[model samples]
Target chain A: MNAGQQTTRRLVSRTGPSICRSCLDTLSRQPYSTAAAAAIQTEPQEALPITPPTPSPSYALHAGILVSRPPLLTRPPHPFESAYHLYQKRLNERLALPFTRYFYIKKNTPGDLEWKRKIKQRLTPARDIGRYRGYGDEAWNDEVLVGAQESEMAWQVERLLEDAERDGGEEEGKKGEGVQTVGGPKKLEREPVERPMPRVTEADEKGDVRSLGRLLQRSLYLVVKNKEGEWVFPQDRLIGKESLHNAAERVLVQSGGYNMNTWVVGNVPVGHYQHDFVPEHLAKSANPTELGLKTFFMKVRIMAGQADLKSNKLGLTDFKWLAKEEVQKTVDEKYWRSIKNMLAER
Target chain B: MALRELPSRAASAVLHNSRPAVLALRPSGRRNASSEALRDVESSSSFEVPFVSDSLVKAFDPIERSKRRRLGKKPLPPSRYQFRPPKYYRGPLHPHQPPPSSDPVSREFIPGPFASPRLEQTYQSTIASDLMTLTYHHLPPGYRAPVQLQRLREWTGDSPYFKGRPLRPPRGGGGLRLLDPPRNFKNIPEITKVVVHSMVPEAQDNSAHLHVAGMIVQAITNVRAVTHKARHNVVGWGLREGKYVSVTADVEREDTFHFLSKLIDVVLPRIKEWKGVAGTTGDSSGNITFGLTPDVVAMFPEIEVNYDSYPPKMIPGCHITIQTTATNDRDARFLLQSVGLPFYGKLVD
Candidate 1:
């Protein structure tokens, strides 16, 4: 019967394996099981499909947040990519049009003299654009721009400025200065100082999991260690009748504290992870009706602040803002496989 | 930032260029040279710009010199070897074939739409991936989609005309529905170009209204507005046949980005009570159109900066058409919504 069950399981596994297979059978049967099924399945498989399949095992729905900080800095290209680009640059340079210096620059003016004085007359045959110089015959050994992974936090600043401009417009309009006064939108022109934050933070150096400062060049997802000593995204069981998105909002606050400002990307769940409850754990809890857990992941972007695990009522043991690879390493193989697709590659 | 990245994308085309021109790849290229050189000497280190003083710029007049050069000289004759593309496309077998578009001198060669905008960047980085995941249909490995009936139906009951007739289109009126291909990573909806069109009815009576409209449109869009002739008389809108009724600027390439960013960032916010673009804006096909009133048009920074230059009443309202690669309105709406343009009222997706 056990071997028969395994074979039958393999047969109907495509419908919905494990706990939900029975309910899936009822759904599929109503729609009429395909001719393809009859072509593939044997007589023995058909007998077990009918009986003891309508019990309708209930699974608790969970709303989980994969709160992530998008890559703060664009990643530097690999050595090969940079080299290919360098080659392309040199190729473009070699097959280029002649520069009409006579037209653009006058013969003996200060600007013209400065152009002659400042221009580095290299032995290379090609007239170059910008500073990727190919000195002499070794022009093939060109070095392309290696965009350093530095955090200017320009996006954050731009967002703040945009928000300010938007919010301030109404007040300015009320003052009769916005549209009326030629003062024109109050320009906040700050001379951009090179106050770049170090790409590698102190948290990174100390290997501190609690800090969000580490990993500037990759998407850092929030993974919390629950009471079960398992690393998972911030998750909790859904309360009665709340929508999936709202449940996600409530779940995050319930598990983690209210210190962080988060923007949930959309109302719908990105993906879901399902696991059959362990028989032993189910026995201990004495829950005959409960079969498994299904977590619907809501993608939330953490704009500012930190997850305060200490003050949280749900009692999460620890938390880490780790990149994709680190996330895979921290979570179980099954859990990793399910949620990995939803997370950003970098 | 876009100005710095412009040159590298000169070879690329009007498409989804999310990687942000080749300048981002190199360290030296990444340095903000133009800004440092042009703005001030103290702001930058070591590198010195040539003395670009007011006197130097004032003295170095290209227009005056060009005027001087052409003062007495007759126009130069057209070069003997200069190639003009065939007026008609001869067969491929013909000896005097037209050059491919890739050729630099080809009339069809359009070098730009370079430097994909920041909005495209936002789409590529975040919105696109989010959309793909949300719309993903996970069919467990070998699960086959059930066979479905074709939308178009065959003619029945043997009418003589029906014998050789092609399959009739779906039962709806002669409206042809766009093919909604299943969403995947590769075929993500992308913004193509923006068309800024303005109707100047007063232009028929006096040409100044048309010129002012064209100038304002050109200033805001960074693309020269082309005057469009009315095909026939429309008495209601004051349009007459052969009359210069409207001017339109097709904002493609870098201008699309610039125009969109300027519209969203500068102008849209300044509006006192913008309820947003109408929800039923998009045609069933990909393109979405929204209109900006003359009052709203006044809010554009380019016009606002030089408010005294134009007559206040002459500013013409324009319809902005956002063309996207998506085949349907829903996808186009999603793309625009993700880029922070809200759509209010009954969204008919």
Candidate 2:
């Protein structure tokens, strides 16, 4: 007999001759419900080995607000990603049925005439959509194509030269000089579309860290100069019996003032930082038992308005909205190491 | 509609294709007008333009023709309006083919998402980073995970045959469940889908129960409910075999975000004495299941807006299972918690 059969026979014999093998099997399997219950759970949040409890020393609890403006714009695509996406777009366009132009543009309308004039200027297929300038390079720097609007630039330059020739020779340039050059064409009814604002704002040009407008694509965090003459997120000593989240909100309003609207993410702190007080600083305090400060950071998202530091409770000298890498350079190394993981990379 | 537009569109398409050849016949005639037109405005080339003739444009009156066709006694052929995607992918070698689903003409194409949900934006913007940071455990470079016991146990007797014999299945007659992978930037949990399922035993006698359940589910989820039949008879539950007793809907993509946000922001708060979801709801894997009572379900805008229409007695309660990308319940719970879901009781993970 096979070893498998032998084990089954021996198991049946061990159980007793009265019990059927199948019944024994089922009885053994009875408690085997969803195996999800069998899986072990390891996280013991309260039992974190990060800090060992000290029997003697009393610690000062501080609440810090990690006030941040989430990314204002999407991160630019990688070179390879843009290329792949462009290839897929082009392939889809090539295979797809032509867009029904008549559905959108009524027959013999100005819009229809304008569309006709556009396609006649170039051999553009109905399927070519958006600013699809024919797949030369899918660069995120808007280098996707050299330009479909090269002819657009040429006309502007042509008009400028025409204006110069007209004014320089005999007449002054008129603002309302209606369509009167070369083969005369009537003005179309469509409004000239406005160009999008440039990505590089004035704040970026002047290298202003205080402006929320700077670094439009990255996560900008608020860091204030503390009473210690060091840059940190605005923090304050916890009030008696105040919860961590309440303390966080209080400290944030006390330090930054109530100019901005903010929402705290949750009741539980996202992270905590602990550091020892200098001997001189502790000696100056009334309480003799206090050893060091433990700051629990609560994440607060800034929906609107800027941090106002004039009504400061913590005596902050300055404030700046800095991106992740900029925060690293501005804040001390130890502080950076402690808080870097919490910042979103954009 | 595509069929009605076909005759005019097909004729124009023919004109567009044959234009270059027409222009090639009179190259000199087309060249001079183009140069004159270019100095100020976009150069209008009559021969090159797709819609050059006003007569052609005047002839393309779909509204008038459609009216005439509708006025006719006999309707158009049944085959003209219907378009069905091929039942099977017959392979690349097959000649007769269906267009890819992404194609506009493809039958399977349902266009959207028309807009990004507010909760989806919030999660992508703020909550995602918090989850990643909170879960991250720093291990030194080149450090390996501790070895785990093999799932299949070796035979205990150490009989010579046991050495190479096929090891037995793990205890409890199941494979090791729910992988607990180390947290990193790459594996941050994001919700995949929310499934709303309602079981209506009353539906066995009256199909109206099933219909009402379906309407409520579809309204809240924005997806059609699929009816399910009981495969086996259960005497105590009064469920007979092949009985239609349940309706379910899978809320996915933008619908999932909208449903979750509506639950968190509106319906859930309205329920009095709500202690929040039980922490033991998750099934070890990243799926968390929780039930809403009939009154709580009715709290949704879909039902509350039209409460009179639904028979007051037959509103079915449903279990919502949120499926996330996380491998374990711990990460899934963290993600849901960050997205404004509250959990009470001892967390199983």
Worst 10 residues of 2 chain A by lDDT: A34-43
Once model 2 is optimally superposed onto the true structure by TM-score, how far is the C-alpha of residue B53 displaced, in angstroms?
20
Model 2 residue runs over 4 Å out of place are A1-66, A69-220, A226-315, A321-346, B1-84, B88-100, B140-142, B154-168
- Tens digit of per-residue lDDT, candidate 2, span A1-346: 4444444443334433345333444333422221112212322332544445345566788889999988766455444444444454444444445555664466897556656654543323422233333333222222333322222323334443443232121221143356347664443333444444666799999999999999887889999888888999888888887887799889878877899899877665667788887899889988756888888888888989889989887889999999988998999998888898777766
Q: What TM-score do all the candidates reach, one by one?
A: 0.61, 0.50
Candidate 1 positional error at A33, Å: 16
lDDT of 2 at A331: 91
Residue A25 error for model 1, in Å? 14
- lDDT (C-alpha, whole model) for all candidates: 0.71, 0.73
Q: Which ten residues in a row have the lowest lDDT in candidate 1 chain B?
A: B40-49
Where is model 2 chain B poorest over a 10-residue stretch in terms of lDDT? B43-52
TM-score, structure 2 vs. true: 0.50
Every candidate's fraction of true contacts kept comes to 0.05, 0.05
In the range A28-57, model 1's lDDT, one tens digit per residue, is 442334534553556555555444555456
Given candidate 1, what's the lDDT at residue A142? 43
